[model samples]
Target: MDSQNSMRWLNVIANIGVLIGLLSVLFQMKQDQELLRVTLTNDYYTSYITADTSFAGESLPAIWEKALLDPKNLSLKEMRIMESQTFAPINRWINLYRLSEAGIVNESFWKSQVNLDAGYYLGDSYGRAYWEVSKEDWDDGFLPKELRDHIDKTLLNRKLNETLAYY
Candidate 1:
């Protein structure tokens, strides 16, 4: 009877060992699956955020008019950002940046007026916004030629014609 009892105890121990081995294999498989998932997620994100190759590290200098006439002179990064962006009311500065690169937008250009509707439409829905420029930004050559000519000719002459002359 003692021998029989000893044999039963050994069988129970063997069964426990087999169960532990199976659990170990399961755990290892779970770990591998987790690792694979992480790798795939990382690969997807890496492909998503593409970097602009052109003007990646370029700076927009203040000489804006010169920059506009020579867009090819810009770095790839600058071109990419400008091409992709849409201007907003807050990004008045960005409009200036794009204008610098736009090459030609008529010879006589004016800064933004106080009203929001005072700007021109750019390609795509992204309007190139302007600032409500003070009188300081307005200079001799800035206003459109027709408007300037009319102001000088009509308004100035109106004043001259009002002056008294000897009959």
Candidate 2:
């Protein structure tokens, strides 16, 4: 009887240990998920800053201003520069849209990004003109239908000469 009691107690202790082990693993996994989210957010900001500064110390700004005022009058080289500059933001938007769709990015953050993109890309005259010419190039499998629809809806509502306010 003593041996049986001892064995029963040992089994209960073993079961408790197993339960504690499983709980530890779950806690660790949650921590790892949160860490991943933080890492991705950091990487996103780093990439954005890099893109924003890519045209610094160059003549692109003057060309950009000229294009913004009169896109049709730009030379071939100026048009190419405009296209290259536009690509950076477009690529960022596509990446953010994909991340948002994958649940890696929060909806509110994604919506804010979309709003900013709409203000710059759909509201400005040169941006709208660029989209009219370049959108067809993105009709390949790379651009998702849902994102395209979202952009088109934003474009429909924006004015051609609208500008983004800093405040």
Candidate 3:
């Protein structure tokens, strides 16, 4: 074969090799995602609760119902308080994994990032729920100490910043 033809063939072979490598990489990623421990059963439950109740679990739903029924629990718009009892010990871990998967950290930061994420989610989720019940009457403050305590304004901001550091 002429030198020109030989060069063309080499270029074509290199391109083919790159395509195959990319396909393999994509397939491997798909396999890893498939291996994710997140189960559909749990997803179904969480989605149903969020969509129908504007809530996340049975305990919170039950408390909301009880609060609505009981006259003593009722108070002026801002003071009525109901407790949230999350269904499992799963919330912290799951939120951490979600944050990590979004590339919030490098592998070396995984442990600390996960810890911080737990604190972030704890205060944020409770604060969100409290806001829903109180409208805007409640200040930007987090939930009552009795309900959750992994966060303070200072610590929470630190966790958020740390999680975003790898970016």
How many clashing residue pairs are found in candidate 1? 8
C-alpha TM-scores of all predictions: 0.31, 0.79, 0.33
**Which is the leading candidate under TM-score?**
2
Look at candidate 1 and tell me the lDDT of residue 30: 78
Query: What does candidate 2's lDDT look like per residue over 1-167, in tens digits?
Result: 99999999999999999999999999998888778778877877787678667764377778777776777788988877767667766676677777777677776675577666765744667777777677777774677777666677777876666653434
Q: Tens-digit lDDT track for model 3 on 56-145?
A: 445554544444344245344312223322222224334434434565423333345334443332233343344345423433232233
Ranking by TM-score: 2, 3, 1
Model 1 alpha-carbon miss at residue 95, Å: 39
Worst 10 residues of 3 by lDDT: 78-87
Clash-forming residue pairs, model 2: none
As a whole number from 0 to 100, the lDDT of residue 89 in candidate 1 is 22
TM-score of 1: 0.31
Q: lDDT of all the models against the reference?
A: 0.37, 0.73, 0.43
Ranking by lDDT: 2, 3, 1
The residue pairs found clashing in candidate 3 are: none
